[model samples]
Target: MSVRQTRKYTHKFHAPTTLKTDSIFYRIFQSLPSTFFELINQPASLAQAYQFSSVEVKQLAFRIDGVFLPNTSELPIYFAEVQFQPDKKFYSRLFAEIFNYLDKTELINNWGGVVIFPNRSVDTGATERYTELLNSPRVTRIYLDELTAIAASSIGIEAVKLIIEPESTATTKAIEIVNSARQQIIDAAQQREIIQLIETILIYKLPRLSREEMGKMFGLNELKQTRFYQEVFAEGKLEGKLEGKEEGKLETIPQLLALGLSIQQIAQALGLDEQVVRQAAQPKL
Candidate 1:
């Protein structure tokens, strides 16, 4: 008789801290890429000529969080990294990835790097090897905490700052950002996207609170009355109804979930019952 053996295995789920922060930065770049150039003290107009993206170097198994590529050779390409935790080898890894990308692309234009940290304390990366590079003008480092001292009227900057705002004050800052976006952004669609971004940020920041509670905390009912929100939701609802497909409405739940909205909120937004939304949100496996 053959001997039989049994093995037990356990799995642990780890919430990705880097992914959370990176998602916020990616969304910011997607919605308002100019805010990035603004943060680096560069002309915001530069954003107009650049499109932001994330790049991966599969050969070395390296990935860059963000890259702003110029439309032409006239402008330098930008590499952006959001570092919330301390890593002794950050500069080494960053430079390696940057140079690798440059080598792979064979671009002749100059390049710049921007690193964002929550504060100086967390920027404990070893820099002895890259001292000259770090000291050069090609690299820019931003401490989010330092940004609070300057009073900026730009809605984009305000939204960026809200990410590092303390929990006690985050709600207040978010309301201000929403109101500022409403007044500053003339385009209705753009204004709504900004508001949605703000909502997404708060959802990540305050995960303990239910969506209904967040809506109340941020005075979302008042926001719903705004023309931007009304128009966007009305269009979505009309499109779904016209298709006469329940799946059309359900498809939005995943997006809302990705934005940190709870199933209850998704249900309310889609005019569906909680069970239906919950079922749709479940993993197919």
Candidate 2:
């Protein structure tokens, strides 16, 4: 299976800590209803997904991982940031950048903002700073790890991974979730993506499982032909186009990069060799 190219900006934002956050965020966004795009004035399908800005605010230069602008003339723009660590200054920096964007854009309109944290404990900002703002209803903070009421729906399974648990339990649950997802999803493309996601999770949780178990888990042959598998292949085509071989880079490279895939993963996603991806990573000059 080929790993596709993600957005160039994605390369700037990856790390072990962020990978889990990214996976969950991507899945959440993917699973949202079509009306979500309508709410944000975005396209209906997941085709043209995210618009990332390395310099969301000049001088301040915040990298926005995902953004969705309202289609209606009157609605406010939505700014989203994903944080996996516990930083005390999170809100301080967040509001600073937000006001900077508001001032720079001269947006004399209302704005909606969301900050997603892996778990409630990861949020270290002073509640006092956001007390009034939280009361005002324009901002929301979500902690993925704190949600452990009961699994009323399938989405609840993804939510459990955010919890701080023994590696063994997490691995067991992840395996259960993947098995369930594979059996439940009929769409080949979506099913493939789910399996890929499961594999990615297992790579991190490998310490919890025996080497033989891990190998057996990933040894399946059907993984190479799933929709998720093909998408990664498509990413390679994008990398080629971006290199000006056949398709335009603007259309291809940035698209894959935007998906936040790793260079190696992108290479695999596209069915290209690692050397090709490494070469593509270099500047035009």
lDDT of 1 by residue, 1-285 (tens): 000113211211112222266667778888898999889887888899998986666665555658898989978999988777777877886787788888877678899999988889878989999999999999999998899675664778888888878778888888888888777878877877887788777766766645445444333334464343454466666445524667777776664565455677667767789999999898888
Query: If scored against the real structure, what TM-score would every candidate get?
Result: 0.69, 0.55
Candidate 1 segments whose C-alpha is farther than 4 A from its true place: 1-19, 58-62, 217-285
lDDT of 1 at 30: 85
lDDT tens digits, residue span 1-285, model 2: 001123222211123333455444555455433323433334555324433222354444444445555445366666666676666766776776667667887556577777766667667776677778867668866555544543343533453352333455666766666667667778767666666656555555443444335433432234343334355565566435635642353344334544444566556655566676666666687
Cα shift from native, residue 210, model 2 (Å): 5.3
* Model 1: how far residue 102 lies from native, Å: 0.9
